[model samples]
Target: MIEIENLRKEYARGGERVVACSVRELRIGRGEQVALRGRSGCGKTTLLNMIAGIVRPSSGRLAVAGTDLTPLGEAARDRFRGRHIGMVFQTFNLLQPFDALENVLLGAVFGGRDGRAAKSRAVELLEKVGLGDRLHHRPNELSVGQMQRVALCRALINGPELILADEPLGNQDPETGAEVLRMLLEIAREEDRTVVMVTHDPESARFMQREIDLTTLRDGEVAA
Candidate 1:
């Protein structure tokens, strides 16, 4: 499970402190799919980055899978996050030179495990996402939907309990976006992993079990 309490993020922008995200509380459980829906400047990405431990919170508590990551030193936090959290960026974040299979395998290596089992898992996931035939294709050769599936496989390669996806289908056409959304939820259900995603599309919000609007930043805190 993931527990976020009184989470606040303040940064020095120019000369004054700026609040990117100020959340009173939010909790996500295993096998649950939650979507954060809001406008562009509402801090969804900031919240996701905090969960990934890439950005530190100015004050508050964030615990994922029993680990309190808010206080860990930078290096320790990085290692802990690599072990417990897997993120799928809107950009796919694939290596330009690596093939699909190799790219998925690369994610597993970052999870700090031997690459062999991860490679095998990647194959199974690719097949699960209906991309078995394109295992060796490079990003340049794959369709937008295909690339998103490849990203999904990479995110799950490390066997993370919590999957954080930021606009998982942002760049795809309507048809491809719908397909990606379905596949994401299905895979999350089959694997019994927790998923929290942020998307701007209203249609996408309806697909989630529950939707939280971040547009109303209240009491100097956000809630779902």
Candidate 2:
């Protein structure tokens, strides 16, 4: 679940404060799958980052899963995010040096799980994503789609209650992207996880239970 009120994020650029995202009020229920839509530079990704606690807000309030992130320090936010949120970044964000299995295991470790006990789950996720034969491959050794699947596995290895995905299907071909999104939603439905995804594609938006146009919540100010 997510709740926001008068939330705004601004960045100092060219000696002036530029608003990145502003939402007067928004609420997403538990187990909901929502798609966030907006034009380029409209702050869709910024909103997702704020909800994940990776970016701090300049003003207003944000609460995810009953915890208010506005007052939490970076360290505390990191701990809370690790425990409650899973993120699928547009860039994949996989460490180049770590193999696929190691990359997924790192996610579990970051979430405070024991690496030894997490290995089986990591392998299972990789296998589920059709990466069983590439478990020992590094990022450079895999294709773009493969790397994306690995990132998905890492996000799910922690069994997070909320998943925040920014352009999750941005890099893959149509078939691969559809497959990836299908797996994500199927797993979320089975586990009862809340999902908020930013997407530009209309077909992708159709998969969500609800669609939100970020521009509609901007309150007359343009996002940078």
Candidate 3:
């Protein structure tokens, strides 16, 4: 459900153009789970950001879920992304003052569909992620894993077509991480959505159906 052709991103660093990420052609089918692995600064996150419409590519084409994101304006991109992409950030980007349910409800609000049914779905997703009792709890009061679960719920509240998770299990113990990853995969499968996760952990990458090493992808180079 994702297609990229001649995609490249460059930024001016120290007055010099530095190529961040480049992929001549890449395709991910619907309902597939893929893991992107590489060392720090390998542009894994940059690629994800481009797919999420947070970053504009310097050149080439990008299409997600049949929508060509290259031509969309910022406001349009934001609206499209809000409806089609669910993102679980590495840092758990939750609002400090909002409770778990409210945070999840914001997903529907951003997608322009918030109402009674949306609120009910938010609660159901939070409960599905084992945070039923923590609905009223704010980010500061929740544990790291709990906060991450809440973030996942918020991401899924819109029933996005694609899920983008960056270092999804980066902060938890091994046991907890495994459990969380399994839960994530299970939910993704049940929803029949595409998942592209960025992680440095080899063990975590192995959980995915396919693994891509970003180090092997060079700027202007095509995937053979």
Highest TM-score against the true fold, candidate? 2
Residue pairs clashing, model 3: none
lDDT of 3 by residue, 1-224 (tens): 99999888888877677778887778999999999887687788889999999999899999999999999989989988987999988888999989999999988899888899999999888877678899999999999988988888888888889999988777767887887788788888998989999877788888899998877766544322
Model 2 TM-score is 0.95
Clashes per candidate (backbone, < 3 Å): 3, 0, 0
Tell me the deviation in Å of residue 113 in model 1.
3.5
lDDT of 1 at 90: 75
Worst 10 residues of 3 by lDDT: 215-224
Give one digit per residue, the lDDT tens place, for model 2 in 13-34.
Answer: 8878889999999999999999
Worst 10 residues of 2 by lDDT: 215-224
Clashing pairs in 1: 22-221, 22-222, 23-222
After superposing all C-alphas onto the true structure, candidate 1 shows an RMSD in angstroms of 2.9
Could you tell me the lDDT of residue 86 within candidate 2? 94
Cα miss at 95, model 3 (Å)?
A: 1.0
Per-residue lDDT value at 35 in model 3:
94
TM-score of 1: 0.87
- Model-by-model lDDT, in order? 0.82, 0.91, 0.87
Residue 66, candidate 3: how far off, in angstroms? Answer: 1.0
